[model samples]
Target: MSCSGFQPISLEKPTPEDEELSDKLMEKVRSVGGFDSEETKESKGAVLLKLDQIAKEFTELLSSAMSSTEQVSGECHIKILTSGLHGLGVPTNKPDIDVLFVGSRLVSRLRFFSLFYIMLRRKEGVKDTNAAPDAFVPVIRATVDNVEVDIVFAGFPSKDIIPGTLELRDDNILKGLDMESVRSLNWCRVNAEILHLVPEVDNFRNTLRAILVWAKRRGIYSSCLGFLGRMSYAILVAKICQLYPHALPSDLIKAFFELFSKWKWSWQCPVLLKPSTENWEFGDLAWDPRDNPKDRAHVMPIVYPIHPHINSTFNVTESSLQIMKKEFNEGFKVVSEVHNNEACWSKIFEEFKFFDEFQHFMVVTASAADDGRFRRWVGMVQSKIRNLVNFLEPRNCISSIRVNTEHFSPVSETNKYVRRWFVGLVSQRPLRAKDLRSPIDKFKSMTVLQARRVGFYTEDMKLEAAYVDRHQVEDMRKENSHFGAPTLSNTAAVGTGEQPSTSSVAEKTCQYDETTLPIPPKVRKTE
Candidate 1:
């Protein structure tokens, strides 16, 4: 196992004070929903069982449905396996169930996505199926039996084995795999590697659960908006646990904030549970700033432990980096004071006052014609919004930007599918909305331009960023803004009278790249 870190910074046991605090920490952690109950875990497992049956049925149906000319020479075996937090034996409430369909050489990914997608729609309780065959890691996202499931595909070089016979430890498992398949498998591989590398699985999991709750409540949990994700947080906690292998969960959590609050981060420094070098690596370039200049540009590199090591925090930007550092420093003070009996553990998990953090706020809104379209549109907007932050950084009038990672759905918008993301901004005094117009406009245009280039842009999709002041934000609070817009109309809202800006443009046809379009698959049913 590659769980050994660079070196043990300290192997000290927890002091009496830390142990005493731990008792309270565990209580507080449970109270704040840090861990899931037995009932919830069982419920999630049941849902996975249903998905497994559905997937197996789809595979059988696919064999009989495909043309003989298109079929492979041998039998196909497929296994549906779980990964991510649930796979790690620690899960949060409303967790997205991540699974992979591991197939023998006979099954291709194209068939898996298309046929299974069709199969899902035919099943009862399977809805909201969206296929992004051309995504960074192609996936068929769907909600099965009321549980969100992300299904990706990977094919073995030879015939797939029986369920429980395939082991990831064998380095030869990676040979001859396509890049997309390798990336898809990395999610499961890294999760397993982390479990192997941790000194104490229970303590590591407890610390991870507690830290995740704290990060989410503190508004620094999302990977989409340039902050540490669940896996990054896992790798980080595993590294810390390795350093203090003898400590309890309480002490490890304490050490986490204390060490990282003042951590000296640079291009050369990255948080790795195992060393960066691995023998299982495919030929793809790993995250080596010394060798690849582009890798050095990442602000917060939490290296994933697998072949072809990647920076989990590659999306992190300078402003987001500053925001996280500030949170860490504050967290250090809170955690340190707990040891001194000056503060309590509950104080550490307090919710981040995002709405009250700034003078001016920008409400980024996305509206589309349907739920599927809205979900797809929202994903595109969230991915590109970080670039908008990067663009605003060069402006002299703005000092900082804080994106609230949570998104909301409009409570009363019957006309369209709408979602809103609020951004907290710190302005350099003498604020003026007109000054932000050009940059805000650029952000909107860039979003649409990307949607166009990706061939997903549609006329019904609307993106807007309206600049509003503190007083106007209060009005929104009274209107129940957190859940969603109180009364969003197809028209617009006027008042604070802050005049929330509406972004729109003349409709134009998208110039889709003909070569990149996914071919629609045709299936023939057989009795």
Candidate 2:
């Protein structure tokens, strides 16, 4: 039987050229650090172990405290299960490891946010700890063993203890859970389902890896900033693998772009691994564009392959959808040519040239008082860059928002706390400074409110946006030449390990404030 959303498109196997292309794609992806090294694997494993240890310690302490405070019948364990790419076994060279703390009914959210968060903050190996208990999906973001880790919480209402053997695949696990827990638990559950539904897990991973590298290089991978996310990319590739069950990675890659490039990504054509079977009680949370205007409005809706079935690409915007479509069509052209000759793989995986492409540009600069505030301030700035893109996208003048997801330090930047992001504001007609006044002003205002909500805003923390042309962009790029490759900040780990910036539902949690591009002053204007 076919494992895809529909029957197999074709059982035809890949030709010799497909094998060659797959091999080349794998090499290119690996060269750009798309896949993990042995050392990275070891480091990531160590971080997971340290995280588990912390969760166990916190649970033990909580169990003791609860026993003393009240009459507890049985001891329930809090299990720390790794999620995201790390848990999915398709992690890149530097995956921001995401782990979920599954607790019992006795363990409340207050304790996890307070006790577990504090414990994580003080843990010897953990550093750069931050928490967002008030966010839509509260999480404790930290780093252990030089690898970023975001610890999310989920407690079962029907269980006294979350034993180690408990499987989240069970639908009842989400019963009586708040929306927050449901979202957090879905992190692991969705990844598990993707792996389960794939016809060939290894092939799916390789195909997805190549696509991820390509998407990153093309600057269309960040869900936080109005682009397809890791989950979306994974599901897209997995679907291709399902359609071509026996196809190799090379064939899957070709099919991916070919099918998606032409597919109408509309409400009538959502990419689903399975049908929207409402078996559980959280139908209200499930995605149904007909009932929910917000869901109906999503330009590119990619449904999660599990219960709740939320649009994994919930953050995608019209501008982003158009931008991604362009890339897909071009990718199809390149990958389809692999049979005749070796496709220009280099062109496919080249670093996005923000300074080269487009005429007018929008420069967003995030400035802080000092090193202590710079990272956090920059993160808040990143979270709202998409809003700016969203607003600008609607204008008739702005054709697309070409954002370079990598971080670039300004040249001759003496503030030591300033980082600049360059965005290619593709406008049809010649653009002037005033043309973007309304959107730029609105974007800055949104940033201010978001910063205040996140409580990271201060007098010294500043966000400034400006409109410039390609000439000015070149000037700024040259000024920052000595700064070398983009800065690899902890925030650069865009969950998928591809983009330097992330957006959307990924940031709805604490990760929201920590993801973007700031503008440089070297190219303020051009005559």
Candidate 3:
């Protein structure tokens, strides 16, 4: 049951020149705070070792629990499926660990999830165990020894017993499985698919590491924030490798920016692999633009290389698409500059200049009673902020809405749990009457609606909206030195790419209910 068809190609040790390039890339990534230093790597390894121990302890305990329950009959297998193991993980400041508990008959997800939650609760130093059963991707997230761990369960039929050494690459493994099971498997499957699709593994990994840093520094990395997520980023990089199979890592890196910079996403989606009709055996829809009308709706589709073959970048909005296009062009220009003797890698991964770009901004703050509540509440609100931007963009009143994409904690010790997010607003014209008030009211209502959806809206849990000018934002940043520049202008399009307004931009505007106005989703979902 080990990796059946996909075996990683072994390579000789990196030569001196390769080492030099690797060091340079690592330095560049480290400069941007993403490089995994030796000490950090050892610490992460220790965390994984501890996680493995916990996984083994939990599996044994679960087995005992199942044995006592008359419904449990067969053995359960525990497997660790980490993005890091598949070489897809970038050396980010925070590393995520995923564990899958594959069970056989009588072990329902609810039962398994409940038992694991109980087990983790009883275990020493396992804190903040939240088993979200009704979530879109139901998972049990907890902190074990201060390392974040996400746990999910996959149960096979009564006759089916998953081996400990099982690899999910087999299509038969997925047959008759539910969407959640498919999702659990995809944690590892997508990485495998990306790695296999690329021509050279090292070339892909190093190139991806560089791109990851660039994306983070430039503030367009959040998939939930309507930008490319890890999966989409991986596939796009793999596609570059597919295009230039024999290119070195450095060349591939440059070509990646160059190719995607000029990519006509409006005309054709970026798909690394074609949709296989045979893949539908598992009842998941294969991504076929011709067959699935929904697929055509993706503004900048980066189709998943596996079944349930949907666009991973479907969360990208028209505005985010425009921002990404600008980034690609900027990235290419930076890389090209480095190609000349004029620049270094740091120039490509430079921190974004966000705060100085706009005159007005809408600052949204989510205050929670505790650290745990703050994390959950702020995350729910942040994910939906793009929806607010999407609502404003097409109305033609607001020129552009840019999300800061970073969260800041309030400076006051009394408000330690308060987290704030800022959205840069570009007014299409001078504010006339309540024109500004309408969009603000709409945004405030949307945030409340989102908080309610997460069941996080409560009396003590407060959501505040305040409009601040550039001077006010600067003062706030000075009060909280840790906060980044409070500007959305970092995402502003470069050059004369039609800056969202005509010369009559100074005209006064009105704010109304606009009941007749159409508002699109933060990102359009394929039907």
Candidate 4:
């Protein structure tokens, strides 16, 4: 049993009557600006022009600025990878530009420091360096003509500087590179072929959106940053093209799932954590898991359903997985109910009349399913809907909604099973202080009321118990001098006739056999 069940139904290419229905459906898309919407075309054009202007301005600025700086020993080169090169067809509202700074001579330590200083000085007007450096970089973001451009300066002296220098240079270096040639590479061509293979546009957009959201939440949205975020998206897209040759967006997503499911390691974007363990920073890097002898170069998993530190960093009780399951189940119900009722489907179609080939497919599927007109139509509709659901099913789909670890790694067929288990754990049992680990080792954090809340302890009873425990501890310390041994000072003990050693009291109060506590039962596996 696949995530979406497989059902066989005969689907012959539409006859004349079916063609007529398709024509009518296509007309609806045209009315709504399906493939040839003027607004979409105009928007795309505007994005291209804006990117072009930015690239030109940047090149001009570098030419003038670098010429003046004698401290800069090499010729400055500007590389631009814009929407025009991505061939996304849609107009980009925020086009990403990759900038590289290449030098003729080896950059001295002093020169590198000077370069860093210049950037710091440039950002001084926008960001306060008094803040942590990691926190400051995100605030360093600036806009030129309403276009957000992220600039990274990589100084290269010679082509063969590092052992894997050529590969890295080829992957990242964009000096004197032809934009047209780069866009026309074997990979790009492969991507285009895959795009053509997609039968529906909606499925393509849905899959792309899912991947984007996943990347964004994980803090890996750009290829320039590392392999996990934007680079991962690109790699998946490229892989789709390579495997299917003419795969559609739905096909791509299905393929991605198939590939991802087979992966032994969890898929996570790696972030460079500070020594303080309070924050994370981005770098030009990739996963080098040398310890894994079989596939040493494979990327490490960074995306988890529930971040282990979910209680602390996110300040939410529910894990990312739990939220995703709830939302996905809800969405599934909505889709199913809408499909079951002809009037509801009609209402949806009336509002979103202007649909492309993709939209037509959805309507047809729904209509066919509801009408009980054709068996194949119903199966196709269900299959497509399941695919859509799977693409949008993950916790990352809903912005800022966290889920439990169980949601991502579900042990049951139904999400309800996981939800019930989570609720039972929080309600029936008290989560011990020791059980909650600090998201960061440096922080001596405890999962008190706040932590439990973030962990999705919605029940008022659970919250009340935590509060009660806290109040009891405070009251006990105040009332009983012997029981609440003051380790800090002898002031409290002085007032009492007898003084017990702080260590002795601590030993009596805190002593608990770890082996006696009952461990929570693991979730039953779904066959």
Candidate 5:
């Protein structure tokens, strides 16, 4: 199961063969859009550096503002909780900075956002700053120099002065805080906790980079759309490291898919490094399915290894969960093939058959007059597409509803930015017009209302819905030649909205799980 000479941190450096494999793996990832290229990484690092500087300046300004206020008795401090600084985040092209403002205990939550908003308005290069004090986790999301920055505020313990080295680990840090503050604190706390749990930093980072990109490409990565978020994926990878502390990136990557794909979800087991000791100490109840019915209802529970151990996959519903499971199974088989020399590593991250999979497709198109308007309009529609999926699941005739993560731009003279997402549909019985009408109408109404509620409704913005046959999809794909391969090479792999199960065929020829690695005691027994 394990590759030789690929020891954890003790190994001086990867051996020649190990290095070759690593380079090959990373290169394969890059080819299939599973990992960022070196150029992309370097560019992202530059942006992050600039973001770090901006965050520092913003913090200083906030501290000055708080100190000037009559309501503040003592000094207020602000710090940018950099994930890269702490080796917590995999290097990514996305510029999402989590900025924490530590203020005096006397300062109110409302005052924090209000003051931050004012400071943002005065600052040059800052735009789209919105302050929602009433939000469950009060945050000020804004763009500085076109990079997204998320700002959260937390106060010092009681009337105590802020320390130069403030660690959120102190039990008193979150004490007497409202739910929103506690939630906000978790952004930093959880990141810190995950970093602490991971044994091999390099192995964890590299393997996670592959998994994260793969998940995103597979379309099962969106947290906003009831799928695994970054934090949840981090927790899962960290747990794998706990089990195999010394495994290299290659071994860990194989083990990652193997372990999760075989995971017994019906048991309702939670993945944890160790039994959670975060109990009523912080006035929060740790997740225990036996006692909390809410915990029992989670379709897929990946418990965070921290206080109040919330299920990071709480947003997952039955439909999304199934989709994720099928994807995991596919990933497991593909990796198995690469290991057996039956296929290249690229096969593991190959694009799935989305539009061409089923006989009929639900084509939902959102068009806008400009790129800016289209981005906002499409984003709102994408976030709420899960609602449409959930609504379709209960109907008896529907086999599966698969959403295309990649949208297409259909031809339109008036529409400057036209993005269309296809929802592949498979029916248990013969397709009937009457059965499809009700769900389509319901989906249309929900999308339209959501667009209007989110202020995306305009004369320039439009929504189009239609059910197209396979021949129509082929014609559309032919029309758009710039898009990648229009069809999967293996026709057998294309069927039923669910990904075709290749593991059964892969198993006949390949011994993917030849190594009998011992499962950890904690992993075997439910807590």
Candidate 6:
């Protein structure tokens, strides 16, 4: 399907005045520092520094508190995830710092509870030690350079399958640390690749910026599962990438759908299904699956609801879902059209077949989604799309259309002939500009090279027509201003001197113009 709806709008090219504005914007960037430089840190700088300070202080305080506790054993290891240790390449006004604590067995559990309780406690002073519960672990709040900090702890299993000491070994925690770092690095690399591959960086950036804002507003920044969140999605993607480095995007999407389906019905507890209701018939309920299937179904199992914290972290409202649907539909349409067309696919593959490897990686990972069979089928289709992208990578042309005072005109006959010849040369074998012949041919042919540049001249005539139409409408409105004279058909209030307002005769004149506005085309639905 052709994008006929996207008729090129005739717009005037940037004039000298517009050039001045562009220059000013560029200058502002320079004055602040380059885009990638630290000088232009903006609000992100303050946030990062604050987070770093908070992490250090929190780590130290937790270590000191654990060391003092007689019940605790081993050391503590605290690692800050996200942009706290290394920036994720995006400018953030206030980015969350995810910290993971790997440490002693008993101490880790106690510290985790104590840290959470102390942070939530309403009292200012410490209570009697004897009155504290056996599980109570004291946590002292200390400022490290004035930045606020929060610490959470988790225990690592020892070789004997028992809980380890509070002092977490580097070897035990390395895998998780590496996983987070690798994911962050991959995210940066993927975005950079996108900028390199996509012609319209500004358009892409604008869409991403809008999505980011919407996600933040909805509190769905993380793709964590259980709740509708983005962090879980990201983590899933990262895990897939780790497993299948060459998986295609389509494979990942299909896998996600499959997982969603499986997660929907895997845990079928009636109580979980009905969270609002309470069951208080007995203090404790015993389950005998054979005799009491219904009761068994209501039993709460460990990890019954996977990643329960996700629900609290993300807020996926109806509006957010609608926005995502719109964007996804647009992208799906564009990609599908390019993939299904044999000619386009062949062109893309002719230049870049290696991209298929990436697709394969994505598909492989997606196949691992909860519903294996369904996910596998989805992965297969995604692989096909990736192959299509590879096929069209070369022939696709992108050019900026310009509208000037000059009327529409084709390139000179000689330039056209040269373009056809160059196209033939490149068509035989994919070649960059360095391999091409004739400097003049290459220079002049840029307008018609692989991408054709189409130009139109409607600035003068179109503006004049629009101005005339607008003025005519204004004049007609003025002439009719007094045509509709208002007279009181019924009067509820009248002054003593007012003649009963003449149950006045009123003439309401309505004007109709036979102007037809353009109707937008209907959007197509995906099967």
**Which candidate's TM-score is highest?**
1
Q: Rank candidates by TM-score, best first.
A: 1, 2, 3, 5, 4, 6
Better of 1 and 2 by TM-score: 1
Ranking by lDDT: 2, 1, 3, 5, 4, 6
Best by lDDT: 2
Model 6 segments more than 4 A misplaced:
1-73, 76-79, 83-91, 112-151, 157-229, 232-323, 330-527
Tens digits of per-residue lDDT for model 3, 54-92: 656655655665556446456655555564222365545
Which lDDT tens digits does candidate 6 get at residues 33-148?
A: 22334433433345345544543544456656545544555554434332121222333222222233334333344343344233323223322111011111111222222222
- Residue lDDT tens for model 1, 1-527: 12234778788877887677777898898897777777767777887888788768866766555444465455656887776677777776653577877887767787676666666766888777766555556666667777766677888766644356556644567788886677677767887888888888988988888888888888887666667777778888998888888888888888888777667676667888766665345433457787678777888788877776777777789999999989888988898888788988889999898887888888888888877667667767766677778878888889999988777765555644777778888888867878778878898998898778766688999999888888986765564434621110000111100010112111111222323433233343331
C-alpha lDDT of candidate 1 relative to the true structure: 0.70
| Candidate 2, position 187, lDDT | 81
Per-model TM values vs. the true structure = 0.88, 0.87, 0.81, 0.35, 0.74, 0.27
Which residue runs of candidate 1 sit more than 4 Å off their true CA positions? 1-5, 15-17, 65-72, 160-163, 278-285, 413-416, 480-523
Worst 10 residues of 1 by lDDT: 488-497
lDDT of 4 by residue, 39-108 (tens): 5345444544654444344434444554554344444333323211234332222332222222223332
Clashes of each: 2, 14, 4, 21, 0, 28
Pick the winner on lDDT between candidates 5 and 6: 5
Give the Å error, residue 437, model 1.
2.3
Q: Could you give me the TM-score of model 4 versus the true structure?
A: 0.35
The 10-residue segment of model 2 with minimum total lDDT is 518-527
Model 5 alpha-carbon miss at residue 456, Å: 9.2
lDDT of each: 0.70, 0.71, 0.61, 0.27, 0.60, 0.25
Better of 2 and 6 by TM-score: 2
TM-score of 5: 0.74
